[model samples]
Target: MSTLTTPHRPSGAAPHRPYRPSGLTWTVLRLHRTALYVWGAALLAAVAALIWLLAAGPDARAIVGGCDASEPFPIDCGTAHWTTTARIHASGLALVSACVTFQIYAVAVWAGAALTGRELESGTARLAWTQSVTPARWLATRLAVPAVLLTAGTTLAVLLLNWTRRAGRGDLSGGWFTMNVFISSGPVAVGYALAGLALGALAGLVLRRALPAAAAALAAAYVLHEVLDGFRMSLWPAETVTGRAALQLPHGTLVLEHGAVTGAGERLSNNMACVGTDSAAALERCVERTGLTDFWTTYQPESHFWPLQLVESGLLLAVTGLAAAAAFALLRRQHS
Candidate 1:
């Protein structure tokens, strides 16, 4: 044979790298490709709807606006096309809003069940550790990848939502503090998503089972959110507008409490239902019957929107940090 001996490699030549199923980041992406696809599809759908709304928004506004000022309202406009357009836009907004609102729970379930628990249950995570990847590194990669994706996706969705809301600003009737509007319109959405991911990962590390971990994570997230929602109003001080008579709060004011005030300054919130009665006599009787003198209203102005959102976002991010720290600590303990 001309060369029976093995070919000699150069002294300084690099050795061929061993094959792996995939790199860490690529593995995470590949494993959760279904979720990625779903996320992408949602974004695409929202973008498409928003683009259509932007195009149709002006025409819809004009059609509704063109109505005789004396007419009843949109119903009196009598254009089927206008009705259809408005309905479509409203439905689009509802769909997108629901997605944003539910993202926290969705992310929690996925992180708990698919991202961590399933791998642990099947011994895949142990396998990864034996393949020259440290436990911390693997866990870090898992959380980091999803965190980046969540942030990017949520940010985009919020921007798109803000744009769409602005497009329909003339017709959209709600204060900024409204739950759906508040969550979908600001950076707090990102905070909620990340918190969900961290809490889910913690749940996964603890449970090490798919269904149970997912359920636990979801319940935990819901409880935390409910608690947070309860404290939202207290995050910032409300502006009080008091007057000797019924006060006309500025448009877009988020009235926390409005009621007639007695001479002793006691706020009687339960007594205001009759103030706006169709019958003038009934309104007078209600006001006089209550012996109310001054009126006071506590509210959040439009300017308070960002302050409230930022505070709530900060609290959520703080929770995320704690959850992530717990998960890493738990993993470290187990690895040791």
Candidate 2:
């Protein structure tokens, strides 16, 4: 009877469950809670701004529309109303898109300084390595977690941005080819952010110092951005149109190379004779004098937006993979 008896518990007492911590994911999240919060707040702010702009768009457009019929909305159009509401809408769109496009810089800097570099520099990573976690697992968790969060946040922001863009189509300052709009409007923004993360991690591994690693990461990201932007137009095949028809190409055409085409089929860009030809009659004289059979123009239409985006994103993701692989290899070599 004594062996079969069980001890009585207090009325409020509950059965104990194991106090297991949430493991590496929780650890990483806790370690970088400030950055996580900042990122979330930033995205929320961008979305909120865009939503406001979307709602106020019609009113803004109407105010501007009531102005004089100037081709470009004059600085004094509708005086205070146009200057206040319309410019505010334009500025909001510009600001949000610019922030979204350039967020990769912040991502790279944070990833390098706080995410990986600081931990390694302070020997926290070494301590983790000595514990149950391996360096590979630690690095994987760092990259993968940030990447997932970055992708989800950026993708949502971009989708909302696209919707807002549609709502304020005519009010936009520039077309789809504009740097901020182009970069922030598609999946390429996610690729850039992930690339920033990978590049930052690699920089941290290579430098092992927070400040220098952050600088290196920023420099690397800038170089990547500039290079990709320079080559973006060349990623997909552009349509080549010849003759007078090329001069009247549609509104959104991204004119890459426009000049005179020689009878021998040579493409001459900015032929010396046509350098300052202001009038259509003068341009015709220049083309005829330059032995040019037709005015040839190579350009990308609005339709090529997706193809260019995919190509650029593919290249960026390729960079991400290479950087991540290099970081892992460097870690193995140093630790082994």
Judging by lDDT against the true structure, name the best candidate: 2
User: Per-residue lDDT for 57-92 in model 1, tens only?
Assistant: 757656444556556665556665566566767777
**TM-score against native, each model:** 0.84, 0.83
Candidate 1: worst 10 consecutive residues by lDDT?
A: 270-279
What lDDT does each candidate get?
0.82, 0.86
- Which parts of model 2 have CA positions greater than 4 angstroms off? 1-21, 61-83, 261-268, 271-293
After superposition of all CA atoms, the RMSD between model 1 and the true structure is 4.9
